[model samples]
Target: MAELYELSMLLGDLEEQLVTCMRCGMCQAVCPLYAETGRETDVARGKIVLLEHLSRELLKEPEAVKQRLENCLLCGSCAAACPSGVKVLDLFLKARAIINGYLGLPPAKKAVFRQIMTRPALFNRLISIASRFQGVFTRPAGEILGASCARFESALLQDRHFMPLARIPWHAKMPETDEPAGPDKTKVAFYPGCLVDKVFPDVAKSSFKALRHHGVKIYMPANQACCGIPALSSGDRKAFMQMVRCNLELFADKDFQYLLTPCATCTATIKEIWPMMGQYFPPEEQEKITALAAKTMDITQFIADKYVLQRKYDDSVDKGGVKVTYHDPCHLKKSLNVHVQPRTLIRVNPAYTFVEMDEADRCCGMGGSFGLQHYDLSKKVGNRKRQNIYQSGAEVVSTACPACMLQLIDLLSQSHAGIRVKHAVQIYAQGLG
Candidate 1:
């Protein structure tokens, strides 16, 4: 059929990259899903085999191969540990697009991605409406964690503890700004990703405070679109491109030194994924995306590198203080190699004593939509992370990604553990006061 021919053509782009995988099984040692399920098909090597079969037309049912591919967390663990430097995540994303194009996305996903997610104004309107009425269906479940649970039995919500949407999201509170850089200071264009904008507005506020204290000027546009990872990870390339263009157009004329985001996932998507997928766009658009990607920085990285030495931390502080531990989101650590900067930010905050958790860089298993599509598997991986946090003996757990914070809250709340979750920027911002 013509559809299969097109699918093969799309998959052919990755053929040269795919052959580089030597099937060394090094990925199994780092894969979170493979450790939990222990299935060959769940590991990167097995999925690579399936992709090769489909690309060569050796597999009859591409849908089965698609299903096997969707089982991954997209955490980039295998790619980070790959001996041959296979670029496994890149191959998996493109392969998903190829196979999903062949099989067609489900009606529900099609509607959400195309109709709602790609449109910023419509998405904000719907989320605002949901925030106003969420209390009627959800009740505060974890007072210390500040999370909520379903008021009644609901299959969609799954009795999971979640952060309620802020009645006034960050965009609604501080709509737009074009603050010029102060003398000898860096100017940044801030992209507070969806979770920070809606559910954790305080993180956005703290980032603003920290940036302001360092005399960094900001250009924050209102009605910014999603970073497209949710769509791209779901294999909806059309929706992903739409979101990317929306953001690129909004940020086109702004002359900022850096494009910073408080969310690790968003920073990684813009810096790494955008440029990697730029070949799909027009040359001009590709140029803009590449330029923007070059300037993208995680908030912690920006502050730690530029501002840490400039400021003074009270070095004479007592050891007996509020103990804190940090969780490295996979996108920040494995994807972008940003493990040290967040720790550096924490170290510069003298009010809190930093403690290292066991396996600090392990994936917390909140691969964006991975938690929603595969909740049981997600929870299993999260519980292992929770045990590590518990063993760390810290009262507060800090992480760079809002998604990781959500997963940590769920695991701690379900187990009735007393550990609280905060963004690294939030902790660093407090010490700035």
Candidate 2:
């Protein structure tokens, strides 16, 4: 045995941050997984207890600790509701890194995230090939959600109603852009994260159209890497750092006042995780990373703050016209304290009556890898969200995170549920006549 790597060095830094958790148990009230499982380990309080144990060396089993850590949605609900202000995100992210560091990456994910994801060109090429071959191997399971099931019992496909990769990724289609920021306007560098670039290219296009409609100067550089959420969440700090370094170099000295991203997960990771992990870097690099983090903002928040919407409110409902519900992504709402802005942006479109779903801010159980690692639990949690969406009786369920859209589609599609998953901006952009 090479001997499992020790986590003490990193755990030392997290001690003070973990202490702030206070074991308040308030997180239970809001955590979606906890709501479903009723397990302390599934909630923030339980996760905190595990961390305290891990830090104190009460638990020697890194795998056990890692499993508990992975049980979370990383939705930031507990952090949002925490009174003592525990940096749950910092703790969980670092904890995940600690455990992943010990066990090493799984062979399959290592092949994909490490060999493939780290290299954008190869990653894009591989997914493109998979997209073309998908039809031969997969069959439609649900037409309502445009979801497909495994054509055969392939070990890779599992039970996923995966959103097939688009024929042309955004980067392939839009290699780069430089269409003048027009007049004296602060140019924004928009970073549409991987899913938006690949799986939901139209969402990225709509975001681009909406930005242009607002007359904001935009500069989207090509070859942008993953924002490192997947790597970081896996505890492969090396891969995460690779992604960060790649992104930093990509947007080097663009003279843009803001870094805007349509993806909620990307926005939160840039705003919160970038500055956080920067502490380990040398002073000069740290300063630059800190500055970059400061400039990043969610597109919805940026639009709400920077542009004034010319509202077209029709107070009358024309026979149940357009019922849409907004689901708050944890990163956008909890991590960023930005729940109302997207809703406000939604309301700008008077044609649709925006009805808030029950536990609108609840985790949709996507949690990036949480869905992959614990698919059974993911669906168990997602089923609740599906019921909530059905309960809301809204024609559309809009959220900022594309990952959530994927999960919602899987759940809604399988149940033969009549609901549509969408981005709030997509709804708003549709109203931009």
Top-lDDT structure, candidate number: 1
Model 1, runs deviating above 4 Å: 1-6, 55-59, 310-318
- Give the Cα error of residue 264 in candidate 2, in Å: 0.5
The total of clashing pairs for model 2 equals 1
Scored by lDDT, model 1 comes in at 0.88
Q: Model 1: per-residue lDDT, tens digit, 1-433?
A: 9766656666777787889999999999989998899999988899888877775543577767777888999999999999899988888888888877867899999899999988889999999999999999999997898889999998767969988999999999997999877888678999999999999999999999999998889999887999999888888888999999999998866789999999999999999899888888899999999999999999999988887774444434447768888999999999888977787787677778888899999999887788898889999888789989989888999999999999999988887888889999999998888
Candidate 2 lDDT (Cα, whole model)? 0.81
How well does candidate 2 match the true structure in TM-score terms?
0.93
> Least accurate stretch of 10 residues (summed lDDT) in model 1?
309-318
After TM-score superposition, the amount by which residue 359's alpha carbon in candidate 2 deviates from its true location, in angstroms, is 1.3
TM-score of each: 0.95, 0.93
Number of clashes in model 1? 0
The CA lDDT at 185 in model 2 is 70
In model 2, the Cα lDDT at residue 127 comes to 82
lDDT tens per residue, model 2, 184-298: 6768898999999989988888788788898877888877889999989988887888788888887756778889888899998988898899866778777778888899988
User: Superposing every Cα of model 1 onto the true structure, what RMSD results?
Assistant: 2.3
